[model samples]
Target: MDRHKVYISSTYRDLADYRARVINFFLSGKMPDSFSLISMEGYVADDIQPSDKCVEDVAKCDIYILIVAKRYGFIPPDTTKNPGRFSITEMEYETAVSHNKIILTFLADEKQVFEEDSDPDAALLAEKKQKLLAFKEKVRLAKLTHPDGFTDAYHLCFQVQQAIFNKFFTEIYASREENLDKIYFCDRRSQNYTFQKGRQINKAIQFFLINSHEKDMAHFFVKRIGLECIESDIRTLDLFIYPTILDNSDFDDLEFSMRCAIKEEWNRNAELKKFKLKDPLDVSVEKVLSVMDELNYDCLIISWEIKSFYWKNDKLNENISAFYEKYDQVNATLKTSKKIFFIGTVSYSECADMTFAQFEDKIKSIRYGATPIKLTRINRNEIKDWMTDFEIEDNPNVQEKLLHDLLPGPDPDFYLSDLELPLRNILMKL
Candidate 1:
């Protein structure tokens, strides 16, 4: 196994003990593979870490581990076009990002971080807090890491280890390019409409009446279906996401608009890097049919965040009507792929709040007189079933815990808004 060098970036004084524990964790050889650690603590310096030297070390590492606490750390002189300069810790993070290092970030909860200066000048302290907040925002925006929160060194270490193994080893071993014909999946998991989430995404290709998190669930099913496609050699799975539209003016033709929008998320999504994607230039009935020709693709997921187009200027509304009218036929015409879909999203109040009869009318209006599909909502039983299904390589008993702790009361329906935050919290546990 190649020895992956990991760089640790954080403020020094308050985190000194935590940093030591992490260094010891690496030194103890508990990791599945070989790893080398690089930290300022090791470089014979207490607080005199030069920004240039720190970022230089960051560029040399294979992985970057960032810890954010209360302090913003020492700021160095302006460099590399960064306005108002930045802390040495943040500079290291920026360097790691620029060099494309795999980053895992863990944040300390407010209770876990005690301000060393209990009473400082209000103005100076406020300035520091603002800068720290801005830096935390940067970390969250980067999306290079999930930014799991931790309360203590042990919790941080455990989660960091879990994140590392899940991202690298577990993924490497769990996902093999399998020949699905040889290995069979349960009928429930097969390439059919049995999986509720999978079916919802496939049938309702565009427009999720979900109040919150339009594509989060969509992405989940897409990945799950992608796994199914990999298992069976029926047909290669391909995903084409017609990126999120910003404003009408931002729309640069149909094809390039999607491509440009996709670039913003392209680096953050590893699964997307594996997709055999295509850019559709034409929306006409015949050209779309030609484009949908299944040369090698079998299972395909097309998620176009067409929400902007639905509410943009009158011209766009007309264009969208014509566009959906043409592609609606392609949805009916495409026979080669096992699954092909488009999914848009909106506020729950805006879409699914009405009665089913009213919803059907709304759907008919949006879909131009075609048959409508029922919006998927989660129930208590499904949440229980999902918790029961949660299994992790690092912790096999995690499912039991999740079932006991996360399983909600027996509600008949849990809207998308209801479960999104809890779902995120559950992932943090992993």
Candidate 2:
């Protein structure tokens, strides 16, 4: 079997733990035979320049996965051959571009900032941050599909899985193209509360706010809406449209990013080729609705991530509402459209001061008139039940032993944030 080589690129010391989580998934999780994740940890050698070796690895991969945080990373020597002081990560990106590799990019949310190069000088640190932000902007504008925020390890792996599946549809299934949506090919190995009969899923619900932290189990339910919405007969959502906030982008910028992702998706999809999508400089409500009117799918699932958006701040609201008229109408289409369902995740620190009602009132979001699901905490029974439901580990004694391994203080009740790392370790070996 020929597996896809996915290069995971990021600054090493800052995001070491994050790299480990995603690497574990591609190494030993459910589909290890089908895909492999490549990173610096895979091999070590001082015989070669790190930049040259990194670019060499990127050239071999079928896909490139780039995760960027606040660090500008190691700067290789500038020479006449390659004349700029680009970070090794940037060099690998250039290699990917030259090779025309399929790229899936994830940017860190605003709250996940790292000090650049362990610098103590505040002025120098700020300047390096500007460089990082500039690189992020370059990455965003260069691709038809915009880069998304990295909320958690599970979301990273799932995004990679979905993106690869969509891009290499024929290769994954040995050219059985019809099995695209019909197949539920992998297990839900993340620390999600499932496998019990207690979930009250509403298949008809098309819009909602998920009041869960991005680091917790909310992502699982978001993916569930895409997969398990049985009443709509959607085997799987046709495309992923993630338009996230990054750097200094305003609300209008976010909308434009979303439109670009959506337009590119429809234009690229063979079945949806008849309908044309247009890009206009001015985002009028009419133009947005016109795009919506062109949507021809029976059902579609779209995910939105908003970070560094202080909804409760009157000053920020003032800046946002000026552009709100157009977005208000555009979001309305998704809210009422029978063919669409959306899952939204917001930055935790940004919204901490606001209540649910405050969020609803200030954002005027697509979450209007829908029930939000909270996935913060789960008990011991849910974990054991999830194991049984997926047949991950069948023995009862083993289940308790694993629970002890997963949580702290000998308590079966655990926060999903606390359970994520250990559970991912188990799933890697499962």
Candidate 3:
């Protein structure tokens, strides 16, 4: 049998983990070992200018999987000013699309998009916001479709992931004879949840892999890629579109409280449901929603905080407001969710006594039992102790046992923050 070839497309810095994940998936023998793909790094080493390899690899692939994430701009070679028009990832995508290989795309989830307006530095944030806007435009034009009608860089990734799954899975059933006997593909995404997006994609992937040999398989693949590309390109979008707050102290206590709430919920529901915790320090709105949508948890606790100071400068006011707006937007969005507990706070260290009081007063006005929690009087030592106990590392033997049960080659390394030390430092004097 002729080995099938796949080529991956992605921004090296932003999507390195993604590339590894995809490559690992294939290498793990989930698919036939006869299948092979060009690693993005390997392709780079073989190209004329190193950068041009992405373009050429796409042209060569039987299948091209594009990993679209938040950042998709030209990565410069140390010095900045030469041939600055296109990014390596974008060029690769264009190459695949123009020559028309079977292109499958996956967008990382929205939780990956980081907002910079809350940065303590003013000049740095202005530059970041400008870049964010540019990246937003690029993503908006790239997504094939979006869920909840959002088309920002975050949602774009989700849509691409799903579309790719459908395109590839459906194509496989049409071409491969070996998989003809396979029935009832596993839909891990929806097996236990109300949401069908994940299940649909998994089914699609199963279909694509089964029918890999049909001569016209590329035709179906191309159609899916083109439609998604065009759909995202026609509309401009922004995922995080809120005003900035000028204070560093914004959302301080709120963030901590929200984290505590999430921890509480994780202990209760996630453990009961046998869900392994990925992020232990904090939980966001999306995480809560995912927990709910999947029926993994019945309750969620979330908190928000601002770490800013007033005396630093007025120039940073806009950035501060923009950061504040994100929390406000999130709070407003979760106003009606009775299952989710929301908390907000402003750090007293960065604000004047009067300003801190005013901030607390403002939060008191929120309708859904959402109000300022005055934790400033509480010692940082108390919070540190709580977090230290909260993020406890799993017992070393537990990981070994899980691996032993699976019969894997070796036990995986589990990262543990030193409970003896503070998880992280919170501002005291600011």
TM-score of 2: 0.52
lDDT: which is higher, 1 or 2?
2
Instruction: Find the number of clashing residue pairs for candidate 3.
Output: 34
lDDT of each: 0.52, 0.57, 0.39
Using lDDT, give the best candidate's number.
Answer: 2
TM-score, predicted candidate 1 vs. hidden true structure: 0.43
Cα miss at 109, model 3 (Å)?
Answer: 3.3
- Candidate 1 Cα misplacement greater than 4 A, ranges: 1-86, 94-169, 172-216, 224-236, 240-244, 250-256, 259-295, 306-320, 329-340, 347-365, 368-380, 386-402, 405-430
lDDT by residue (tens digit), candidate 1, 121-180: 676666667888888888877763543355556556655765765676544434442311
Q: Is candidate 2 or candidate 3 better by lDDT?
A: 2
Error at 7, model 3, angstroms:
2.0
In candidate 2, clashing pairs total 0
Over 254-284, each residue of candidate 3 has an lDDT whose tens digit, in order, gives 3454355445546555332454445546456
Supply the global lDDT for candidate 2: 0.57
Report how far off residue 343 is in candidate 1 (Å): 3.3
Model 1, 429: alpha-carbon shift in Å?
14
Instruction: Rank the candidate models, highest TM-score first.
Output: 2, 1, 3
Best by TM-score: 2
Q: How well does model 3 score by local distance difference test?
A: 0.39
lDDT of 2 at 274: 60
